[model samples]
Target: MNRKILVLFLLILLSQNIFSATRIKTVEFNFGGYYSATDIASGSAWTPPYIIVNLPETGIVIKNAYVEIEYLSSAGSAADVTNIDIYFNAGTSATDIVDNITGTQVPDSSGESNLFVARADVTSKITSWTNQPYSLKFVSVGSPHNMHSAKLYITYEYDDTSPIQIKTVHFPIFSDSLDGISGVISTLAQQISPVSVPFKYRCDLPESGITIRQVWFEIRGLRQSGGATTDGSINVNISGYSSEPTMTLDGALTDTYRFRYLSSTGTPAGFAPNTLQTVYVNLSGTANTNILGGEVVITYEYSNNSNVKLKTVSYFFAQSTGTAGSVTSFTVPVYLNEDGITIERIYAKISGSYDSTTVGSIEVNSAIAGNSLTSRIYQIVVTAAQISGFEFYHDLSEGRSYWYNGAPITISWTNTLAALGGCAVELFITYKYTSENKYTEFYRVFAGQTPNEVASAGVYNYTFNLFFPDPEYPVGRKVLRRTWLRGDFIEG
Candidate 1:
């Protein structure tokens, strides 16, 4: 009788403690959309400039919520730039969540101009709000400073019971400086020729038939530089998109232009092709307006039901510039440290200052092995004629497959001297990996810049933010694991 009781007790204990993995999703709300920094001039409680934080109205359990603020200041010294007060108002009442929050200097800032990042955990307050549009207000203290941008991130625990899951794919639209001082979109392709941008999406798979969710196009920081009084406007027509989106800036106000477009329903018309895809994004705008900086963000969704999964990674290297009579070489590092990662392809976008009339060519070469000694694997050439504006972007296709071990691959390129300013290279690598999960999944996020290289001996002081994986939640983290610094060293 005692032996029978022991067996029953063990079965009951096992049944009571069933464990399941935690699932989480984080949504980002960008407040200022890459607009130029605004001066927070006075100390007196500045009237509230309410910013919207987009969150789902219902159906989810939020585990944690945090707000990250990025700002540029030339106010006083870093010491005088002490603290800022933050408040949130749902509708009727205003509650102070973080009072006198400290600011940490970003690694990129130097001298009197400083960049700062301030974070606050508002899990309790954010979870309590039962509606949409969480607006926030900021109050500065001590010396005045400039506010660049603010973002709200909310991570929620959700158990998706349905077979269909919504996926969001985001990629940069354009990262070039449009100088319109001479009254044209400059010499870039937006004015001279057509620019082709290639993006990837998972749809109509043989295993688990996927579906389209929605599409969004976001353009940020569209304005004329040098305080010029020339009104500027741009009309962007993306191939396969439903309609053309336009952004305009008034000559008198000096305010930056931001635009966002969302489809009414799931539109797979643009992404109907199942194989490799290409789309032409044309830009047309007014002349005599020097547009400084901007980016295009495309968002889409798909459905999955297979075990075969897709993973993508992007890395941004330091900017390199070439002189008029010198040969410039830039070595970029590509790291893929995942187990069983079969790399499909790599796409690179070299954006910076390029003159269409310049005479030069850039070549990319990789190292590979064949018989005995490893030889130069393959090469692709980019010439001045092919470059329309300040960007030369394409899918590096030389007909070869790449597999990742545990080491980093270095890609070096040499360019002849031409009328070029500076260039920054960003690479996107996609691969397929197997998982035990029943349905295929897709994960996407924008990549951040790599850390700057340190000098051997000098009084160099700068602060920047680096994202790393957390040992506790490795699955939840999406970031670059390894990076190498590549640039030229010149004595001043």
Candidate 2:
């Protein structure tokens, strides 16, 4: 029975050892030390001894080790202090040299403490120690371990006073894979919409005191996706208006506006297939001066991972301006016609006054010989009370002449003027004859005149007039023409 019991006990011990080997428990060696100059003899000639500490016993071993040292300013005043060497020893004395190691030293010009590092052979030592069991020691040359039980060392002249000390720190090993994985995943998601945000603007009364006639919106998207690493995993789309009309003192009308998108963020990108993409709208018209209100819309689409996507939209509107008086010079297009001739060109002379201090712009359109002659458009602010008008000229005449007997020449004109307060004006149409052969045949004919009335501030009526030239002039190889109203006044 005793022999059988001994054999059973041996079997149980062997099973326990096998079980311990199969279960892995990770362990690390961390050490830290510092030396204070106050602990050393002030006037004695002595070198601090280097010291090293061994790690705890564990089934898992030290995989890696990092050592850093900080020097205290009070340690020494000697500027000649230069070299510092460190070594790893297997035993407690200098003879047991496990590995010869050196630390990187830095200069301290300000007499302040600096840091040093001993990193060579660290990886190889870690690999060997982790595979088996080993001991480690930290040793210094001129600097000795001053503390009674500390691993740090300091060396300096006793008479060369200033407090001197050394500090050593050791880092503990932990699981980096678990901590780093979350950060990597977060970084990957941030790249998808790094700059995808909506933008907004408003129309307000600036210090300059000028009512904004129109507003324009421009938007651009920078692409941050595509490459071997990114793999074109992201896509973006944008759509928005250039300008949306707002209610002004008068009414709403299409005004000046533009929107554009490009491939590159620098200049306008050229339109190409499978390159950059863009969408834009230009909203421009006369603002409604009477009831101040208006709005514009913008939309976008974002795609990541080809299967995941997002959409966003936004809008902007106009604010109201509190003022009084009927808007005169309401924005409108003027029209005109000339009878009994082939109309070559038609000019409308305008005369008016506006209470608003700002100048206004004018637009014109016309037709001739069954062809739409709508190319001559002009814009100018009415400042001085001179004659402001629209002129229409044809590039190619449809074999039609303005001077034929009883030829009914038709002329059309349209005008748009902007201003504030009640406005009243008179427009005059003038006609002239021009030919390549004779510079002396140019003259004016019967002129047509009319008056315009403004019902509200910032609003005016666009007037159209027609005229027929007198039949008493010589009819052979000549043109017939008429002139409309021309004059001016001041707005109240």
Candidate 3:
């Protein structure tokens, strides 16, 4: 038996369940076209993004684990159809397995030319396949010239479980405090995303934790506290999909819109467990003039080896930068603990407005200036006619001593309305700090808009955006006009 063995590797990387869907595929490949004696990466349908999809449960039999090996025998002479041997765990070299299954081909006519098809039963190995990668090897013997490989059949059942889980939900309330020198965070503020922003969430998906059935982006319409209702459609945009889905607006979600990507061909390199994935949501669409803010949600379904559940998660994107002429800004916090960590950099989302007709310019400046580390003065002209937004990044690594005791930095934005209303001013600060050696803790700040930041010092929250019957502007806006200075200081 001058046996010729073929080795192939298949990738059946599963995705997090986003929708309720299942996929069963017959992975196929050719040895003569793929199995190379020396070259590792020559030809392979046995490569990644080309494997079988199964559940996480152990001892589940996959009824579709079989191979249909095809080879043509020339007319006359020593050409004959042989038997097929199936093995688990395919490799790059010729190897023999102790536990193997075999199947024979219905012999084709030796007197005439014919195509030999061999069906091998591989259910024995599949019934107890591991959560790890599993591939089948097919061996065809009995002196057949020009032996090639064919398609593999797999029966995969989609469990269709919930895509996301609400691990925890923080309340809308916020609080903060000063610990010795540094501010100890008691209850951090809730993060809010502004309108027209593709606020992205770094999705943390568990390895093989859940297979993604379907994925969708949902954005709800925004309205003020006891404000007028909006009827017009809120336009939105979404990127980074396997295949962009169609758009639709209906019901209360009429102000809302949803999109789902159908194909789950995204590789293991994409949905590996314990890795961060990108889910971007942008409101580049038209704004509902009557709305104040909107909520962003990523809805999906998944399989957990047994059952499927529909799940939705509220992500890191939440902010309502309504019309240009409205008071649309709040302050976030910057805290550095006393862990001897060096302060390095900081970022902030600066946004503001004045009236429904006229607005002002927003400027971000610091008391301490590093020729290299200090962020430049950010200024933007605001108006009812224009929406102002600027991303401010400043490096605190230069010209400042490393923050050893952790302190607080106030980021303030000052805007003067062109209208007769009290100057509607808003502000936000940047926290640029760092640590030399990895301290007790290490985390990165964000380019963000905080609805609030909770601290251990004490809970003292305030809102001055009150309304009264005013002549110049009937809809009274918040006038928080204040001075700002940037500096680096040590807390004792």
Judging by lDDT against the true structure, name the best candidate. Answer: 1
Ranking the candidates on lDDT from highest down gives 1, 3, 2
Model 2 per-residue lDDT tens digits across residues 1-492: 000000000000000101011111112222222222242222222222332332222332332232222221112221212233333433333333332222112222222211122222232333332123233344433332222111211111111011211111111111111321111110011111222222111111111212111111222111111111111111112223222211111011111111111111111222221122232221122210110111111111111112211111100111112123322212222222212222321222222222222433322233333344333322222212111121111111222242243222333223233342222222211222221121111111111111122223433233322222122224312222212232221111
Q: Return whichever of 2 and 3 wins on TM-score.
A: 3
Off by over 4 Å in 3: 1-335, 338-345, 349-353, 356-359, 367-404, 407-410, 418-492
TM-score of 3: 0.25
Candidate number with the higher lDDT (1 or 2): 1
Q: Rank the candidates by TM-score, best first.
A: 1, 3, 2
Give the Cα-based TM-score of candidate 2 against the true structure. Answer: 0.19
lDDT of 1 by residue, 390-467 (tens): 344433322225323323343445555454556666665555545323221222222121122233353333232222
Question: Which of the two, 1 or 3, has more TM-score?
Answer: 1
Provide TM-scores for the models.
0.46, 0.19, 0.25
* Candidate with the larger TM-score of 1 and 2: 1
